[model samples]
Target: MTIIRSRDFTGGRPWAALDIASMNGIGTRLHWTDQPYIWHINEGQEVFVVLGGRVRMRYRKDGVEQAVVLAVGDIFYAEIGCEHLAEPLGEARVLVVEAVGSL
Candidate 1:
């Protein structure tokens, strides 16, 4: 068992993560970031949860770009091939579950 104080969690750098678990090739991680991630498509499904602060989520759908702001407690789901990007409003913590080794 593990206990994480999400508000107090910190990483070494932007997008740095604390791995929580891995099973069956899937991984759960807690990430800290203050930078925007490059847009990319995942090879498998992804579940993103905002644990602290705010984030601007950008994505391409039907070749058009769209974006939304996610606050604490918000969740984002990405299916395989879903092109997306994440930009922190400031500093933020996010919990992500996805295929291990996926970028």
Candidate 2:
């Protein structure tokens, strides 16, 4: 059993992650960041959960760009082929579940 205190977690740099587990080609990771991630499409589906601080999630839908602010405990699910980016509001910790090696 793995127990993590998300609030106390830190990374070496923005978007650095601690790998948690991988199951059936899917990987679960804990990430820490104080910077914005680039817009990209995931080869597979993605589940993003905010564990600490806040993040502004940006995505494109049907050629239109949209954004939402996600606070702690908020969850964001991205379908396959979804193009998105995450911008942290200061320091934040997030749990991400996605296909292994997906970007």
Candidate 3:
């Protein structure tokens, strides 16, 4: 398998990735700190894998509110049409894979 790497956005501190293929659409999402507990949604479904550190995933209050604490190697999936929230517990790195389209 081929792995594509970013330009090291956070000085290689927090890494991110995206898996693109015909079978599924995936968009990688991440944050440098837990302060920015923001939420967003894409057109398709997505599953997030915490590659390193810890993270807390939640749904937008105005949207759906599903919360989950994720550690290293933890995997969570957001169903299609599910609006969500995500944040790093500290300095964290995450990888997201899902059935999706363009960014």
- Structural similarity to truth (TM-score) of each candidate: 0.97, 0.98, 0.61
Ranking of all predicted structures according to lDDT, beginning with the best and ending with the worst:
2, 1, 3
Backbone clash pairs in model 2 (N, Cα, C under 3 Å; residues 3+ apart or in different chains), count: 0
What is the TM-score of candidate 3?
0.61
Residue-pair clashes per prediction, in order, are 0, 0, 3
**Cα misplacement distance, residue 90 of candidate 2 (Å):** 0.6
What's model 1's overall lDDT? 0.95
Question: lDDT for each of the candidates?
Answer: 0.95, 0.96, 0.59
Tens digits of per-residue lDDT for model 3, 1-103? 8554422334333333333344423444542443434466757777777766788887754554667889888887776666777777777666666544423
- In model 3, state the lDDT of residue 59: 78
Runs of candidate 3 with Cα error greater than 4 angstroms are 1-37, 60-64, 99-103
Name the regions of candidate 2 deviating beyond 4 angstroms: none
lDDT by residue (tens digit), candidate 2, 5-58: 888899999999999999999999999999999999999999999999999999
